[model samples]
Target: EKEKKEKKERKEITPEEIMKPYGVSVDNIDDDEVRVLTKENLYDTLLSLAAPVRQLRLDNSEKEDRESGRRVVIGMVGYPNVGKSSTINVLYGSKKVAVAATPGKTKHFQTLFIGEDIFLCDCPGLVFPSFISTKADMICNGLLPIDQMRDHRPPISLVCQRVSRESLEHVYNIAIPKPAPHLPPDTIPSPDDLLNSYARARGHMSVQGRPDESRAARIILKDFVNGKILSVVPPPILMNGLDAHGLQKLTKDFNLIGTKPAPIEDQDKEKKRKNRLLNQQRGQRQYTDEDEMDRMVRLDSVGHHQGGKRGGKNFVQNKNSNKPWLEMKRAQKAQKRAKKKR
Candidate 1:
C-alpha cells in the first residue's frame, strides 16, 4: 500500500511541482510569447526581439533609473562559440569584437554603444553545469574546441552515430567501407573508417606513414561547426498560424521565396547592349586598307627623310598585302631567339 501510494504521488507530480525546485512557476509561463530564432533569419529575429527585450529591461529597471534616461544595457551571454560576439558585431553593423570558430575567444566582458540610447554588453562564454549524457556531446555541439581534444575517438564516434555513413562519404567525397556482414543491418560505420578514408584522400599522413587521424578529426569537426554537414534539430511543436504569418512576412521582406534562376531575358538584353557598344567601339577604331596603306607610306617617307634605309628584311613594300607573312617571320625570329636564350 505504501509503494502504491508513492508511485501514485510520483505519477501525479504536476509540471509546477517539478519546476518549483528551479524557482519557476508554470502558471506564469506564456506559450504564445515564445520566439524561434535561426541563423538563416538572424537579423529579422533580432529586430523582432529588440522591442520585447528593451521593454523587459525597462519594466525590470527602477523608476529613478528609467527617468534618468539611462541607456538600456543588454547583456549577451551563452555557451562558448555560440555567436555572442558575432551577434553584437551583426547588431553594430561591424566587427565590434573579435570572433573565431574556436571557443573562449572573448576573454573579457566588453561593452559597445549600438544606438542612440542602447548598449550591448558581451560576456565571456562559460559552460554551466548541466545534465550531459557524455563529454563527447559537448565537443560535437562545439562547446569545446576539437583541436584541444586529447582523445578524438569519442567525439568522432558520436558524430558517426548522429550523421550517417552515406552523408559522411558524400560530404567528404570519399568512400567509407560498409560494416561487416556479421554486424546488424543498421550498424553505423566506425570512426576509424571515416578518419582513415578522409586522411588518405586528403594526403594527411603522419611521420610513420600512417593515416593522420588527428588532423582529419579537426577538419571534420571544423566542417561540422561551419554547417558543411547538415544537422538540424526541429522544434517539438509545429509553428502556430501567427508564427507562420510572421515567417511569411519575413520571407517576403528578405525576398527568400523561390530558388528559380532570374529571368534570362534581362541578362540577354544586357549582353546585347554590351555587344552593341563593343561593335560601335570596334567600328570606330577599325582602319581600312587605304588608311593602313597611307599610314605605312607616311612611315616610309619619315624613315627616308630621317636618312634611314627602307629596303631591309624588316621593311616590306605594300606591307598590308603581305601582313600575314611578315607576322609569321617575326614569330619565327622570336622562337629562334627564345631557343638561343634557353
Candidate 2:
C-alpha cells in the first residue's frame, strides 16, 4: 500500500523540465571556448583564443626555442571548399597557402606561421558525421558538387521550401505558381515547375521542344553552390530562439537572397529593347532579286486583269480584301444610281 501511494504521488517529467538545467534562452549563454570564425571577424576570433595576459618574469631556465616564452597551435578543420586555406592566407597576410575552387586541393596538412609564437595547422578537408537532413542541404552548403549529383530534384525542392518564393521569382524574373487560398501551402510549385520556368526563361529546350529540366537543375545547383542562393540552416539548438516569422526576418537581415539576377522591371525594359531592335532589323531587311521579280509579276497580273475578259477567274475573290468596306461602297453607288433613275 505504501509503495503504491508513493508511485502515484511521483510526477512525470516533461521535455521542458529536462532542458531547464542547460539554460533555455540564448541570452543565458555568455562565454564560449570555440566560435565560428569568418573573414569579417578573423582577428576577434583569434584574440578570443589567446592565452591570458601574464606578468613578465625573469626566469632564465625557459626554453630558448619558445619565442616570447609562449606558443600556441590552432587547428583549422572543415569540409572541402570551405575557405580553410583562404583563412590561413588572410591570417598570414600573403598567399602562403594555395587556394583553389576545386575540392581536395590541399591533399596534405600544412603548418602556417601567423606570428612569432603562433602557428595555424591546416588539416586536410574531410567530411565528418553531421546532422544533414538531405542531399540538397549538402549541395547548398558546397559540400557536394552539382555535376556529381545524380538527382537534383530533392535539392531543388528543398530550396523552394526554405527560400522565399518572392525573392526567387524576383531574382530569376519568373513567376512562381502560387497556392490557392483554400489549398494548403504545399500547393506551391514543385521542383519540376521551377526547373521548367528556368528552362523556358533561358531558352534551354530539348530536342522535343520541352524544357530541359536536367540542364536547368544543373544551373540552379550551381547558383546555390556559388552563393547566388543565400539560404542558410541554423543549428537545431538555435531554432528554439525564434518562431517561423522571426526566423524568416533573420534570414532577410543576413542578405542570404542571391542578387546576381536582374530585377523584374529591368528585365522587362531589356526585353522590350531587344524586341524593338528585332523589329528594326526586320524592317531594314533588303528585298532579294527573287522578291523584286515577284513584286513586278504581281503588278503586271493586276494591270492585265483590270481590262481582261475574265469569266471564272474574276469570280474567285479574296475573303479578307476589305469586303465589308467594298459592300458599303457598292450600296452607296446603287442608291445614287436609283436617285438618278427616279
- Which one wins on TM-score? 2
Q: Considering only N, C-alpha and C atoms within 3 Å, which residue pairs clash in candidate 2? A: 230-256
**Candidate 2 on 1-342: residue-level lDDT in tens?**
965765576554443443454356444554575576666588656755755421132143366634554656778898989988888888767898888876677889888776565678988787764677777777767777677889888888877766666556756777555667898764446898788767767767665456789899888877767766666554466677756655444444334222333334454654664455545445445334436545544554463332233664545444334335444544676899999999
Clashes of 2: 1
Estimate the TM-score of every prediction: 0.50, 0.51
- What candidate 1 gets wrong by more than 4 Å, as runs, is 1-69, 232-342
lDDT tens digits, residues 205-230, model 1? Answer: 66445678999998998787777765
